[model samples]
Target: MPLSPKPDLSIIVPLLNEQTELPDLFQTLADQKDILFELLLCDGGSTDTTRQIAVELGGENSFTTQLLDTPPGRGRQMNAGAAVARADMLLFLHADSRFEAPDTLSIALQYLTSRQSVSTHPVAARFRLHFRRRTTHPSLAFYFYEAKACLSSEDCIRGDQGYMLSRSCFEDIGRFDDSLPFLEDLRLAKTIARQGSWLLLPVRITTSARRFETEGLLRRQIVNAVIVNAVAVGWNEFFRELPGLYRCHTETGKLLLFPLLDGIRILLASFTPDQRRTFWQATGRHVAANSWQIFFWLDARHAFHSSLPPESVRLQWTNRFNRYCAPFVCSSPVAWVASAAVRLWHRAMLLLCRRLEPVTKTS
Candidate 1:
């Protein structure tokens, strides 16, 4: 089959041992209408028949499909896929995700181009996620996951959210951090958010929750929360402890320790001058977002699991917190000092980044 000079999108999937999952993914991609796309499967040394299944699926489909080989690891496989992708836009999807709508790609591209027209910089986005199966009646864990995706904040976009971005913007951010064994996608989202708007599209991509089921839903959420926090704090050491800490019997996983926190200490003192400068910039960006989030969260259960207006819910909660904390937490001298210190740190990082920007640009 002849290929376009540039496809509208290149869907990159990093496959390991997903023989059974390939056909459904390929079929779903095949069903996409009114859009041009190339599906590139980066096989990471699959011992199963995943490669054979992929090849057969490609032969059966009208769309362009390629089964490429790579070293075992999602980061390496995705980077390898990106290296050869022939599209101006790229989407890194997991093997277990599938587009339920026939026009999902077309709709997603329209959303991207529409947003791009209004923004001065490149736009990246991800679909809201839906689990393929519900494990029991319903769990608060599911609601929390849904809320995290729906939140207007860019930081909440996770790997399973179906990342989509133009190739140029992707390249500018230097692509995914292939160095990490995990949380590469989360880190990539942060980098993209820094550059421009990171959108969470209303369109939903259903993904397998088999891992959550196997690992235990609550336990998986705990593990995820830990891993995400570790990435944010750049605590490489904590991550080393994760695979074992959360290792399921088939499953299982804080703040205020910053001075002693391995990640924070490394950021402040252990890094080289250049590394420290990068850390400072990242720190400033992070703290600004983090500080807002401290106030953004509401204590009410309805705030997280409701169909009510998000702002209205947040505003009411904020009023309640201010009324309560003002007479207690904020009244104490120790509390005042701690709060002021945090505020000062955020301001200091901002000014430091401003001072360093010129030197970084010229260098």
Candidate 2:
């Protein structure tokens, strides 16, 4: 309708071997109201007839969809599609990820259009995601991503978070790091966050349950955590040691950011500084702080106001900021000012920190 004018957004999805889902995904797009955007599907060496299937879907819908040939990695596929996108915004979606509600795209576009650019955009934007099967387990992916985000800018956001970026912003910062075979999304998410604001709402995206079916819930969760830690510590290759049981997808359920991951760090920090010293010295050898987490992580999260953000999601993880933050409705006046001042000081120190850490590799 309306000749698909110039297209308001570009939705990029990296497909591996999913042929059956294309027809439904395309139909959903067709049914969407006034959603004029180009759907660029990147085929990552799909052995199946996924490419042919995508072509047929485009023909059936009478809309513009193109399949770009890319390497197997999701980051590479997204980068390839970004290189060709004509819209101002780029939404990198997973092949199995589906946004069922028509308002999903509409709200996303509105959010992006409203924001100018914050120095730190919180790394990634995700609406709640519901898994078809394990609809019960909340997504641990958010916690992992948020935990990673606090440690450093490069380690925060990963592809699993349903990526969205401004074309200009992406080009300015450069696309996802193709060098990253696994956490390219993680690295890019931080980069985007640093450049501007990362926004999220109460919306939901429904993804497939194939991962949960393959990996028993709890074991799969460990695999997910291990992989995240491996990537965080520059041991991405070692994650390869997992047996066939983990080689397949294992994640499911909608992701709830903000609290899941951040809350844990807060709880751990409850130990006093001396207590942390004693605890880590006694147990440090048992666990690895290879990357060495931030100093603030040791503080008892509840030490602050009741409304602080946990370590993950990074949404309002900072104890002081979340209280006085505009969205929280009511907060202590002293907290309002203190959090503001602390953040200001943090920004001032960022230059020195950036210099010491060489920008991306270290915390």
Candidate 3:
């Protein structure tokens, strides 16, 4: 199995304590057919045998493999991997990501290449994500998320979906933001949306749902929403002060949301009146921008009930809200109202978590 002199794609995966995940991930890479790709395993100072496992597995893989040592940040690790890639195209994937189809990579590259050839502007691609959970039970939350990932909406194109773009396009978008340890993927996704266009590739990528499973699904989503909201409102201090609030997936357990909510409240209290008002206003605008989710949820609900795919039902209500309602909701007065609603919702969630935590622990 001779590697291509110049691989068709460079697959960059940021790793950290992924010793357990390496063999399966390596096997998936090895299974990729009809596509020549170089694997760059960017290690972020893993204390485990992650680097060693990557090296040993790389030796058996058909494609070219390189292990890079970088500081402990996903953005930095991915950027380092991209720096020395041999291919014109780059695919960024998580270590937990797996492909059911051997031709997944081949199809994705062909689709992207074909789209780029036809379109005047640059096109970036992300796979439709399917969460491989431990349970087989139906969950509306998971269904809604799966549906949402299929959209080109803001904050929808996550790293778990596996981003694919040409090296030139990536360069134009600039390096993944290393300013924070989180939201780097969201930042890059937003930039790509602004500069070019995002295509939801035909192939589906299965990513582990360990985080959501370990830390109650609804609870984890609430935390994620809070984080995204904080980012939206430019609450930099929230992240700076509560740096340990977001932990690694493997380290996650039954998430206690009360402490995090309390910390946020404390941070809010510390702000001046003007700054507080501005923060609330920004939060309102962010909420209004994502108001389409409510309508999309309605669609997802319909799909869920019918046992149909998420995108099966096209609801024009979301479009109507975006065109007519979003502007009005973006105003300061509406924003203030939105802010109040959010505060009330947070209080409700705090109470609910308090009631549920004991039961969860005992059960």
lDDT of 3 by residue, 290-323 (tens): 7778987888888888898765656666777777
Model 2 stretches astray by more than 4 angstroms: 1-4, 117-124, 134-158, 236-363
lDDT tens digits by residue: candidate 2, 1-363? 454567888889888778877877787677666667899999878878889999888887755798899987777888899888888888888777777687787777666566545433433355545555545554444333333433333444445447766777778877888875556776776667677556553455656657645544544444465455445534433434322213323233322222222332343356578754443333222123221232233232332233333332333334343343333322344334443543354345444444543333210
lDDT of 3: 0.86
**TM-score, per-candidate, Cα-based:** 0.71, 0.61, 0.93
The local distance difference test score of model 2 is 0.57
Please list the C-alpha lDDT of all candidates, in the order they appear.
0.69, 0.57, 0.86
**Which pairs, if any, clash in model 3?**
none
- Which candidate wins on TM-score? 3
TM-score of 1: 0.71
Clashes of 2: 15
RMSD of each: 10.8, 13.7, 3.2
Q: If both were scored by TM-score, which would come out higher, candidate 1 or candidate 3?
A: 3
Per-residue error for 190 in candidate 3, Å, reads 0.6
